[model samples]
Target: MAQQALPVLQPHPSCTACDLATWPGLESPGLPTRVWDGGHTEPQPKKALLLVGSHPGVEENVKGSAFVGVTGQFPNRLYIKGGNLADFADVYLTNAVRCSPRTSELVTPKAVAACREWLDQDVRVLAQCYDEVVILATGENAISSVLQRKESLRTFHQGQVADVGGVECSVFATYLAAILLPSNDPSKILAIREHLLLVWRYLKFGYLPTTVKVPPPSELVGSRVLDPSPTTKLISLDVETYGAFERNHRGRLLPRQTVFHPAKSLHWDGVQRCDLVQTCALSWRSPRGGKLRTKVYRLDRRAECDRLVSVLQRLRQCCVLGQNVPFDVLYLRAFNHRFRRVLARPHCVLYELQVLNFLQNDQRAERSLKNLSLVLGVADYRDEAVDLKKGQRYRDSSDPRAWTYNAKDAQATLLDYEFLVEAISLWYGGDTDKWSSYSRQWYNEVLWLTVQMSENGVHYDVEQLGRVHDRHQVALDWLRDRAKRLWDWPMSGKGSGKARERIIADMIQQYQPEDLGLARQYSRRVKKSRLTGKVSAGKENVWLLMGVVPSRTPDRGKLLAYRRFQRLRKVVESYTGPLLHQVSEEKKTPNQQTALVKGVAHPSWHSVPSYASDEERSFGGTSQCRITPRNPGLQTEPPKIEACRRSRFPSGALVLADESQSEIRVATGLFGDEVFIQRETAVLG
Candidate 1:
């Protein structure tokens, strides 16, 4: 079969700018007059979208065509790859400057200005050739020629939608495809593809397509669908497990030992015994619904467990909607590999409520299913007759009440899903298309990314961390002994337990300028107490001891040591201690590992305040490489922490790259801060 010919733009004979010889740069030069590239000349069924480039490159100049050379192929490839755009619409490729300059530098503002008339004429002609013509101005020169704006390309790189030559189009000031392609980063490619996808969708749909199409429940199962198709089927699932497990406020899993149990009046010994799935309750509403069908599968029998796994595998194909789907998915994966693979895309009713709450800007979005059910007026499972927390293992318990609790939970989950679906549908004015798009595209993608991030955890160095912990402990002990000696306190016995606090109290009580031989330089004064509203003798704290003491004072070293001790003590207790406990001893390798879990706001990397470690504050590395396992402040840690940097890449090698001052540059351009731009330009230059 022969290839169909592409449409080309018909040249305007009467237009003076169409003739390259008339332009200033090519007036006394030698260059081709008709530099227009290959495109459809005749009107097409669909609209034509034009991608405008700068002046022709060296290869383009030889070929006498725009976007056919090395530089032009970048956008051409993207255009074809972006949703098969060519099949839907006619695409015209052209340049701002028709005649190529003899020298690279000769393609200047004067030449661009001279060629602007021809570009404008070409756009005017193209606008008439298509029903809806859109122009994508590629670079600075192309944008300037099309938009006729004096501002540089930096101002428009963020992308703008406007009317060009009476045709509505999107201007991409940053689409330097050739430059971006060389990096070979998939993320960069994906970014460009996403932008192009948006552009193509805008051209096809008039308005940008914001919604994602939700696959129908029947379509999801396809040929595997159960007999007798129904408009709606409620599939509710719940799993009961032996042994207690819970997540902390920061979403890190803490052992029962770290958790305070008021009933037991004690904390569990930080050891978490391996837990087993006790029972799984599956409740479903059939097509011919009279009453909900419920079944409780006990893991005691091998046949029953296998049956449960098989059923779950099928349910996964459909939207296995549940409360805290990630938590359920994690346990399911741990139970069976098949369950793990199938439950990867399970929908969470909790996540749906969160999305709706976020959209409404509801600050206090209810997270717990129990709380949410109450607010949403859905059936609350917690009010059931059975004590849900009483049973340890379903095999041991013959009580029918335990099974009823499980069944009730499954039923409640299904009811919650139905209620949320209706609520969200009503919120969107019954436009399922818009609601589906927001849910699948934005909410689903975010949830999926979070799950993947949690699975791809970070590495930890147990040996190195242990060494650092010991050193900190030794230093703290020495600091305490020194403080005790300074205060002339007893070195041994029960009094030593509270020695440090006692020393601090004594120092405060005996605080005098003469004690530090600073009587001549400093004097104490009586001050009104803010809390008691009474005039009292001035008090001295660690800050005053360090800052107010004379430089020549002999006791300055002791005060500084005490301050250092306080800082190190905090680092040991609050940060390192928790982290050390979390490191798994079963791994048997010197380099241990820790994992990150997704939080409501961000991916929890277990970051800690870097200021706690003195070495971290002064180390100065180019990239941020901090890791605070079992602690919630790692992300805030500075890059200077050497231990953190080492821990980031446990294999003893580090590779880090970041966009330097990208936000500052964006702010400079957006606000048109010429002074800041000039200053940055000079400094960067």
Candidate 2:
């Protein structure tokens, strides 16, 4: 059989400007001429540029083709297996520095810079041929030299998107096969191979299969515009707060040093004062497409809030969207009753995006407006000129950057909403589809339910909480004394008593079974390190002392005492003290003897958990009194800590309902399995 003919190498016409023949160490003795797979020997449309570091090995230089050596074979095989690109003929492969370096010294930065002229010309020519050129910079040096990113390769994530020259591309900053060949670890080889496949996927398609694609740059609108429609409208809202000063867990104003403005004539008579001073809203008529005429409102004055309320009231007839709408609504309600009342039914874009992402099982989706804007192809202006970390207040600062940030936030929110709507529509057919409608309605209902629950907070007895706090304190003292006596870990009475406490803690932390002469019975296990290949402790952790204690061990009593002390300490610090402090003295009404417990407001009662006994839960003492047999434990007890106290329902009625066997029912109904359904029903009955 005749051997296949190899394509002849030729120099690019533009290479003459650099005078490659006269360049030091880059002479054409063993150096291969410019080699590329001229696909079809005809002008077929160019798809992508397969950019790499430098020339092939010695054998490849003789053959005048790239990737003919062992170093290049791994990527060639990966490209074929990935199915995105078939063969070498599919892509135009080139390098940053065209010549292979002599000896072992790789191409210097100076050499790379000198050869950049030829590279840039080649890229420009390729960009003209290809409709969209995707450059795959394979290594750290290639990434820095070609992509011009100043950050180290360690900082770059796999399949990270970056813009090179005029085209958008994905970067894979990993060691090439040449570096991997000498390593004994098979995992490193496999990792680089996988990275190669990812690069192929990115070059063939615009993005990795794992990530959701943003809209093309052409589709994104640079300026804020409102496309007016009769039935529907899109309004983006944002609020800038001085600082969150809500009531603490103890029902007292947090950041106690916060001072309110001396404008007593403002309509804040019966309402709680909040940090909300400025609010921005941008309203656009929708079916968000083409040129849009937008209405922008920036309100800070007390009278301006009334106008903002009127605008929001009008927006209620349309779809009002915002990031974390529940939070904005809470603050707006505090600003004025009318603002809250008007925004009662606004659509929360954050919740909508979350629901969509949940349905698609895309856990990487972020709810922040800034992140969403960047992911959805909108330019973010949050980081320019202003340091948001400094917490500059909009009311106090005269700098235009603050206002610009606020306006951009509102604009980004609107753009993100528009993009999500279109993306979802494409994913699940249309707006009226079952999946699409269900997700939107479910999230809306949840948001409203949360608001209602927060407004009507659960009732708590301050007197009972105080009694519980006192009881826990007494129990903690007893446990501490008992543990100290049992374990011979006495507290210090030295100067600055904290020193003695620290000594006791260190002793407890250093405790082991062997220290108590139980090493023979309770042996420590060993674990091997993945990176350093070192062996260390596997099961001798002091925290896991309870698990290691034998059933008939002599030191069981001492271990149990120490555990009890730890539990008591946690309960006093984490629960009892905080709970006691959070019980607000403000009465709900004159007739009703009810006080509110200030838990986290956003999720309202959703985060609360049911209570359990000491043994069932991790908290120390058993519950002597049972509140209810139906709901045995108090909800929202710190997981494993059983120090949960019973609270009386303000309405004197506690009802709980859940979808009974919903998942099984749905599965049976969908599969039309009558036999399985009958069996489940019989078992349930």
Q: Highest TM-score: which candidate?
A: 2
Best-fitting candidate, scored by lDDT: 1
Per-residue lDDT over 317-353 for candidate 2, one digit per residue giving the tens place of the 0 to 100 score: 4655666665555656666666656667543322433
* Stretches of model 1 off by over 4 angstroms after superposition: 1-236, 244-275, 283-295, 315-317, 345-361, 381-399, 421-436, 488-559, 582-633, 636-685
**Per-prediction TM-score:** 0.44, 0.50
| Candidate 2's TM-score | 0.50
The superposed Cα distance between candidate 2 and the true structure at residue 479, in angstroms, equals 2.2
Candidate 2's C-alpha lDDT? 0.45
Q: Provide the lDDT at 401 for model 2.
A: 46
